[model samples]
Target chain A: MSENIKNWLLFILTVAVVILLSYLANSIINRKAESQFAYTPQIEIGAHEPRNVVWGKNFPRQYESFMRTRDTSFATYLNGSKLRDALGEDPRLVVLWAGYGFSKDYNQPRGHAYAIEDIHNTLRTGGPTGPGTGPMPSTCWTCKSPDVPRTMAEKGIGEFYKGKWADKGSEVVNPIGCADCHNPETMSLQISRPALVEAYENMGKDIKDATHQEMRSLVCAQCHVEYYFDKNIAGQEGVPYLTFPWKYGTTVEDMEKYYDQMEFADWTHPLSKAPMLKAQHPGYELFTTGVHSQRGVSCADCHMPYQSEGGQKFTDHHIRSPLDNVANSCQVCHREESGALINDVFQRQKKIKQTQLSLEELLIRAHIEAQKAWQLGATEAQMKSILMDIRHAQWRWDYSVASHGGTFHSPVEASRIVSTATEIAQEARVKLARLLGQLGFSGEVAYPDISTKAKAQAFIGLDMDKLNDEKETFLKDLVPVWKKEAAEREAQMPIRPVSSRE
Target chain B: MRFSSLKKKLLPPPQWRRPVIILLGIGAGLAIYIAHIANVGSYLTDDPTACVNCHVMTPQFITWRHSSHREVATCNDCHVPQDNFIKKYFFKAKDGLYHSTIFTLRKEPQAIVMHEAGQEAVQSNCIRCHISQVTDPRTAAGVSNHAENRLDRTCWSCHRNVPHGRERSLSSVGFHLEPLPVATRKGSFVPAWLDAQVNHTSN
Candidate 1:
């Protein structure tokens, strides 16, 4: 064949093959789109169904993935899915929260699946003999279960809050699950917690106006953000109303101002005599000020990344630290190797932890100094300023470190909060030193040897032996009964089975 | 008119471009020849070995070789549609194009996840292949009930590790990719122009 004819033939063949492939590809894409949209749903989920098993019948993929949260094998440097005793790791926390329930016991939070079980096991709740006897209010159960929303719907919201933690044991059976965040009808993320909506209203912002991306984080904020039980809200008299102190804002100073305005003190510091504030897990609040949040990354973006199974893409509902799934979580956006990304998180945590320890040591000294001043017969007038300083300083420290992932979430902001707290602690100690000098005791008040949790608890007058025995009894006796009652109650609830289509 | 004149001026003479065109044609032919030698055309067949051409697919290929379905099916049996000739080839062609694009770009993620389209095809194939077992009265009642009420339960949704057991480490099979010398991989490796812009903002 002539060169011209040969070239023309070759070009024609190439073009023809390309066109054939293109047509094939286009048809396949169309078929795929059609098939995806035409799926016949297998089960109908009821509105506000708290039982995950019912929802799982419809979304077997999502539900099966969600059940993986029960696997407590993963662990990282600072945080992971494993159940860890936080107090056992850091005895300084006992001194830091001397008068609070947290000082009795605190565990590093595990996965969402363990939320209910962890709450039951924590010694902070104490061994309540019966209803209305526990130190914790019914509001304490607000974050632990999807059943909280169900109970609130069945009973009046006001009536739900008008009880003690022990009273709601059998009622809040199911751990945090689908109904806590998702609307059953559409499976869209929704804030079921009224406290979050009320907090939004307090800030003159309607949560309804929040974008879809914002809802990803807000659903987490339902339980993860800092909140307190307000027993004094108008018309909710004597009921422990769950409230987020975010009206001023979510920043440490913003929340301090809000708390100061309300004159709210969680409890008096036993050592310092300061009207102290205890920080709940401020994960959402701290995360909002983070670089990821600033760049529009939601809590779910890391904690609940999308996973592909078989051929379906759905949210992985096992809510745990991003550190555990660095490849899926951080490495999706970051180009770093898995080890490198993990190292980055660990380094940030390490740096923050160094400062956190220093702040804790300083606060311990301030509390001891304040105790010395009181012992030396310093007037209430003389100690008032010191007490306020201690309260503010400890509040800042607690706010910085209490938010589980705050250090890595916003290292710069976490550092700033800790530094300010350190300064306040030093200032408190300095004033306490002057008071001690004035009262004719000029020598240094030696730091207590609280190098262990047992030692620290002893220093703080916590009878650990009695507490542990009581907890053992409670777990052995009461927990089984509660489980039986809950199982029986759930068994009574009818599961509306879908009629078969011929 | 001015733009067309500029374009003409920028173009080389037809006779002068003949050698360059010939060289380009030779390069294209060589690439096609290499691809054919690699058995790229065999991907259109039911042979599962065709899926193992790239180094990235080594783990998957090895796992699938030992999988329970190895005797009964190939990769296409689950992954590609088998509804009809046109639909089957169409699905294969679309996936082939996507796989080639991602491979050529060197943008394969560490963990390979099936796309939504691939998932649907797999789900459909599962139902088609195991129709009797799936539609057994006891099993069908639960699954069909779910399908009637909410969304059809894709078989692989519960059996995630069926075809591949669980994805073993790529390193275990002596599979690794040489690191790409991309600027985005590290800030220090960025081009002078980008580095200048970055530093300029800082200054």
Candidate 2:
């Protein structure tokens, strides 16, 4: 117990403890590594196997997790796995999409597992009386099933898109699944849809050059982005070739330019009589302009965060809204509390929706005003500029709102798009007012009573009862036959078993 | 100010260089000795023992010990590439360097995670081992499985909870570099909203 001797003894004890702890750490990590490497090939998996059950036999952990996408319990403010009646919630949509099939019925997208079922149930596809009776083209099934790629491979891509929607009902049975975003050979993320590859090629960027992190979002871009069918691409004539109008860029203005160059219109607006552009869900396109994407955050970062079960880690396959799993999705990068993050999303969506609804109302009024101008013997020359204004304004509006999660994905961009749309719509209304005055109708044009979906449908001249009756017949008669045929075909495909070591 | 001037004046002479050199050499030698004892380089191999060199890997080790694959394979069997020696060891070296650096800096997360590369390796390994059971006969007849032709399917995307059971509860046990702040630790997930936003009709 000299003071110097005691200090030396303390230093020695500290060193000894550090060495012991290091040894203990090594022991623990070694043991864990042993457990993780243990594998017994329980089942043999084949190349390009579409059936999930076969893959599940060997990778039961991953398969079981993937199967959880079937659960529809989770929901967020704007979008989730829940099957929401989007058209029912906002009757203005019925008027906005007056001539489009979406006006009949549109539902919020649900989990990947329900892709096939939801498409079948939706009225947009219509009730078919026979193989080619459905209103939709075969191109409609592009994003809904893995069977699409399978069928395209068996029959050529052009041939696949040649028939009607129900023509290949028996062929396309499996819902969006494993084969849609991963390669069976390497199990690496790959873009399955040709449209996405071709879109990238148009932008002079090869998808093959995409980094691993970029592939995460690109795989989702395969189905989530806005697309259209073009029957004019050389050698693919008369086949509704799936194409993304992203040659210029992903911005609303950029896509508008692309469409304008082609003199393309999805349909002439029923009331406005303008060449209208229909904006499909442009999730990936708008998302690319968002803060998250700009900061290099991939869709999978939020929607498919890694989850641990029994010490094994894998990406959560239940892809849905980031808001549904704020802790793993947003909070992993954002330190804000769950309530705060959810509130942030809601606040953005609420504000965007306010402007969205106002723009919708204005467009509705503009369309009606144009119709009134026509009735009053307004010349085509007088109405041409007004119609173009209506088209551009509504296109901007639809572009912002149709992105589904654009508000949360990129609040500033969504706000700017809506603002531009609102200004254009007001200008169109003002022009409409002047035209009405010139035509000798000085008084205000009365707005149609479209307070409800049914009222809106009626105002737009849609016979909902007739549409529903036909849909019912299709579902009851043709649907069962399609399902039965699909089941029988799948049943005929045998699953080979693996021999277990004794 | 006087204390600082006095300290400067009391500093070692410019000619006394041998002691300084010896001290610096000893310091560098000790650092190397410590790193060696830690087995930092061992992680760059197809050895399960290398993974358990870190204390944080205890939960994974315990689970795998009791897993169905315990008797048949080891960690490198699924988590690393088997294509060629160079590629496999290269990945192992990259991963090992990253893990060592993070742990040394005390920057490891509470739970371990597998990145995209690790996921691909595990997925490919799954298909590689169980090739016979999952392949469809139609593929040989020129009807390719959509996954085979494109990058769209992985065995784990569906059979996630197999090999091991529930992971969240299992991973939450045993490993920690330091006690986590109670506020940030995993708790019963409470919703920010009582009903989903999808259920609401915006005004």
Quote the TM-score that chain A achieves in each candidate. 0.91, 0.90
TM-score of chain A of 2: 0.90
Looking at chain B only, the TM-scores across the models are 0.66, 0.62
Q: Which stretches of candidate 2 lie over 4 Å from their true place?
A: A1-41, A498-502, B1-203
**Tens digits of per-residue lDDT for model 2, A1-502:** 8979986996698668666656645644564454433332345444455677666676566577678788887777777877888888899999989999989999888788788888888889988887887898989988988677667666667778888998988788787877777555334555666777778768776566676567778888988888788878777778788888988988999888898898888999988799998988898988998989998888988888866655555577777777777777888678988999899889999999898999999999999899999999999899998998889998889888888888988899999999998999999999989989999998877888888888988988998888889888988898889889988888877666545323
Could you give me the TM-score of model 1 versus the true structure? 0.67
Cα lDDT of model 1 by residue, B1-203, tens digit: 99999988766678868876875686576556545544567876786656755555656665564344655777888898889999999988889988867765558787787899998998888888887776677655657475452236777667766776454433323211212211112222212221222111100
Which numbered prediction scores highest in TM-score against the true structure? 2
Quick one: how many clashes does candidate 1 have? Answer: 12
Off by over 4 Å in 1: A1-38, A500-502, B1-203
Per-residue alpha-carbon lDDT of model 1 for A386-430, expressed as tens digits? 998999999999988889889989899999999999999999889
- Best candidate according to DockQ: 2
